[model samples]
Target: MFGLFKKKSEKQKLQEAYQKKMSEAHKVSHSNRTQADKLMAEAEEIAKKIDQLKV
Candidate 1:
C-alpha cells in the first residue's frame, strides 16, 4: 500500500527553505546582516510562489 505522505512540490520546497532560513536568523546572532538580507530575499521569492499557487 502507498503511504499518505507525498512528494514535496517546488513551491513547498521553497517555502520550507525560506522558513528554515528565518528560524536560523532568529536563533543565531541577530546582528548578522548578510544572512538577514538573504533570508528576506528568499521570503519574498516564497511569497511569489504562493501568489502563483493562488492563481
Candidate 2:
C-alpha cells in the first residue's frame, strides 16, 4: 500500500516510544520496582510532549 512508504510524524514516533516504555515498565515492575518507576517516569515525560503537540 502507498501508506507503507509514508513516514511517521513526530507525535506518532513519540506515541510509539511511549507505548514501548510503558510495556517495558510493566514487564520490569515484577522484578525491579525502582527501574520500572524510572521507565514510567520517562514514559510520562513522553506523554507530556505528546500532549504539548496536541495543543
Candidate 3:
C-alpha cells in the first residue's frame, strides 16, 4: 500500500514514542520503581510535545 511508503508526522511519531515509553514503564514498574518513574517522566514530556503541536 502507498501508506507503507509514507513518513509519519512529528506528532504521530511523538505519540508512538509516548506509547512505547508508557508500555516500557508499565513492564518495568513491577521490578524497578525508579526506572518506571523515569520512563513515565519521559513519556510525559513526549505527551507535552504532542499537545503543543495541537495548539
Q: Across residues 1-55, which tens digit of lDDT does each residue of candidate 2 receive?
A: 9899999999999999999999999999999999999999999999999999999
Candidate 3 has what TM-score? 0.96
Q: In model 3, state the lDDT of residue 36.
A: 100
Q: Looking at candidate 2, what is the lDDT of residue 11? A: 100
lDDT of 1 by residue, 1-55 (tens): 3755778887788778778867876665378878777777777777788778879
> Residue 20 in model 3: shift from native, Å?
0.5
Off by over 4 Å in 3: none
Backbone clashes counted, model 1: 0
Instruction: List TM-scores for all candidates, in order.
Output: 0.58, 0.98, 0.96
**Local distance difference test scores for all models:** 0.75, 1.00, 0.97
- Highest lDDT: give the candidate number: 2
- Model 3, 5-30: lDDT tens digits are 89899999999999999999999999
Provide the RMSD of all predictions against the true structure, rounded to 1 decimal. Answer: 2.7, 0.4, 0.5
Preferred candidate (lDDT higher): 2 or 3: 2
Model 2: what TM-score? 0.98
Ranking by lDDT: 2, 3, 1
Q: Check candidate 3 and list the clashing pairs.
A: none
